[model samples]
Target chain A: MINRKSAAALIIGDEILSGKTLDTNTQTLAKHLVRMGVTLQKTETIRDSVDIISEAVKRLSESHDMVFTSGGIGPTLDDLTYEGVAKAFGLNLLKHEATIARMHEIQPNLVLNEARLRMATLPEKCDAIWTGGLWVPLVCVHNVYVLPGIPRLFSSMIESIPSDHFGDVPPRERKILWCDLAEGDLAATLDKAAKEYDVAIGSYPATNNDSKKLYRTMVTVEGDEADIVIAAAEQLKGALNARYGTV
Target chain B: MINRKSAAALIIGDEILSGKTLDTNTQTLAKHLVRMGVTLQKTETIRDSVDIISEAVKRLSESHDMVFTSGGIGPTLDDLTYEGVAKAFGLNLLKHEATIARMHEIQPNLVLNEARLRMATLPEKCDAIWTGGLWVPLVCVHNVYVLPGIPRLFSSMIESIPSDHFGDVPPRERKILWCDLAEGDLAATLDKAAKEYDVAIGSYPATNNDSKKLYRTMVTVEGDEADIVIAAAEQLKGALNARYGTV
Candidate 1:
């Protein structure tokens, strides 16, 4: 049996809950993690409260193999991720000389004000994961990886993550079938097909917009057995095609 | 002092976690709920597992004044929201005759297969919030309101929800100050200003894109006291300008 790794994301932001900003970090992390064979179990978006962030971090870290947190790591008043992580692990916050040195190296003319220097302070005993090219590094405190919420920065930092972060399990293979029939029309056929395979089947019916396909279904087959996953995809295709015309 | 109402949203779907679908329902509900004096406290996205869904619903409902759930309430095998909601409330699942009648009324020639008819299976005791003309209605089980995931249907259903659903708290007044200062530069100013006012002040710094603004910070002052919210916005604007030389 393949040992599957599980992960969860903690998106810390008041902007997200207030509808002032749309959070794409969760989706980005999910896609990246899924492609790496890590099952993203749950994602929670909470307000930027230090106590709540600390509690959630500790809880998620205990339950999941790996916990990725986005947002709240910025150099601002609302950026309390470091403090939260410190509280969760009962570690003291310390200013790292390396981070400060790197910051100066990257932004030579930038003022090193109290606010800017705040980024150097992080949870004690945490390793900085940097790609050498980027000045900012993602902080890893135990099983929790603290990443900035900015989409570009988050993606860049994630790319620097080591290959072993996802563990030894193979990535999932997905097959999608776009059907002309509405989800209601294809319900029975999908039900039968889903029961036949041990794969994860998802049905997403799009709202009537100007989109070409009325509905789309994705079949994810991931496990140690590659042949079974491929075979299931073939069977699903045949079944769906037979019932409703494929788009 | 104003009594603040709180809400949380549960987005249930495997597709969302798989990165196949982007959930806008959370934001849609957040924007609408905020206008009604309801502060959306948190939002969670979990796979379509009955146990997980039920647990999340129960937990969220207890913590929040109102809970809105989106997705997994469709007519498919994976559509397990009704079951989850029922389990959360410890209520028996019954085929709601009203829902069945509405389903048939909407899709007259549609064949009501067992899978399709599954949409009609709701919790034993619940109120259906419906618009006069729309056949599909949002299900309300205790403090949890079940709305479908589809954007169009979810929005339409939410519109039918009674105004009293968000409680009698007076709507908050909001004032925003857009500044060109980076979040790091204005952290101390924002922190000091936030403590001085009763309003909820949030500083959101946007990532630099191709847009004209290199950096954008949104200072949001929201509270029942219009005078305080407005004064804080003015104070924040002055502080930011003095500190960063506003763009």
Candidate 2:
């Protein structure tokens, strides 16, 4: 079966909104998806509201091929990922016997709080995969995979997911070149090369705080084909060298 | 005059999409707007596309009370913020004579790389304020404000925005409490207190990493009134303590 290509990530938390924390999951997931040959089209950060989470899940799942949500899956009252996922899929959340059993194995002295047990509840019609060392399963709803908000846990959970689970992994490559020349000085040449190679070129400039006189510009070339990507990168490096004497 | 509340934030970069960077600007702006009594209900993140940036500006300005964009204001090829803002407002991206003069004054020996000077270009219809330091101008388009992506710079830029410019600020009375009790165990108490006090309660549960025996529950109480917020918070604390004892 030919799987769809688009994906989206929803990061749920009030901490993110409050500027109390910086979210790393979205970027990590986006890069992972890109490598998987999936196009990450949209990313949204929403407050921990069941209504909002449910709405976002339903809408994104319907529109995109895959949807990944991070955060709000803990045992606290603010963790409403399970409830939201259930509501989104119109499924009843019941504690899974297997998950409860696994929890006991992981923590023999674990005191079963009703809130913590909430983590064991999975939406109907979904398969759950345990991420990291956590005993609770990361529930997968349709094409939506719910992961924890913790960066370490999120990374581990993403790794646990088989590449083939999403679909065929497409070949993607990136090359970077650093130059002392400014971007505007190379805009025309870079734009011309980008069009010619059908590649994407991203130029980032940074000022050296130490010297205050020297500036470094990094140009990134990315595409699906290795030959095209390498060729475009070489072209960019050559153009930069010709335009501005080599550093 | 009853000034309507509106605002927008622009995030410009490929780092955001590539998952190399998680944007904290939206959340920061959202919370700030909420504190300022500005209804920040919508936000979008787009690449460093001049066309996309211009279109975002036009649409957001037409609907929102204000628009604030973070990123794409740098001195790189991807930094299309100035041109984008100009196009959106049908203004010319000309070197602001005053701003250029200030730049020369601040950094006399500054090799005005056309790229570095790119930072001085501003839309004709907007006012510019120096945000990062003495030379960088924070361009303001009507109600829209353009900011840099660097966390410190973004925060400083926002702080420099006078509250009077945005009309009445949002009420900032909010309180938080931690409970050892599970959310489901205290659901009834929380719901009853919320309804009685007419306040909003958000519960977040986290698993204990060390013991994994008890789940840490964080309850947030928010309202327009200080007394009501405190009262609700007290009720939640009392109920959780009664049920599961103190944390």
Candidate 2 docks at the CAPRI level of: acceptable
| lDDT digits (tens) for residues B1-247 of candidate 1 | 7787789999999888877777788888877887788898889999898999999999999999899999998888788999999999899988889978987787688688777778888899899987666666688999999998988888878877878877867678888777777777788888787799887877776665424354477667778899998788888877675223221
Instruction: Report candidate 2's interface RMSD in Å.
Output: 4.8
TM-score of chain A of 1: 0.91
TM-score of each: 0.93, 0.80
Model 1 agreement with the true structure over A1-247: per-residue lDDT tens digits: 6787999999999888877778888888888887788889999999889999999999999999999999887777778899999999999999888898888888787788888777889888899998656677799999999998888888888878987978956777666566656677777776676677666666776565525444454334334467766676677667664223222
Q: Which residue runs of candidate 1 sit more than 4 Å off their true CA positions?
A: A208-224, A242-247, B208-215, B242-247
Docking class of 1: medium
Quote the lDDT for A230 in model 1.
67
The whole-model C-alpha lDDT of candidate 2 against the native structure comes to 0.73
* Model 2: how far residue A129 lies from native, Å: 2.7
Instruction: Mark the 10 consecutive residues where model 1 chain A has the least summed lDDT.
Output: A238-247
DockQ of each: 0.62, 0.32
Model 2 chain B: worst 10 consecutive residues (lDDT sum)? B206-215
lDDT of each: 0.80, 0.73
lDDT of 2 by residue, B104-211 (tens): 888787777676677787788678776545676777877778888766677778878878877865554577666676565666677678779967676655533323
Best candidate, TM-score: 1
Which candidate number maximizes lDDT?
1
Off by over 4 Å in 2: A1-4, A75-77, A83-98, A108-114, A181-189, A207-215, A238-247, B1-8, B27-43, B50-64, B82-95, B110-121, B178-193, B205-218, B235-247
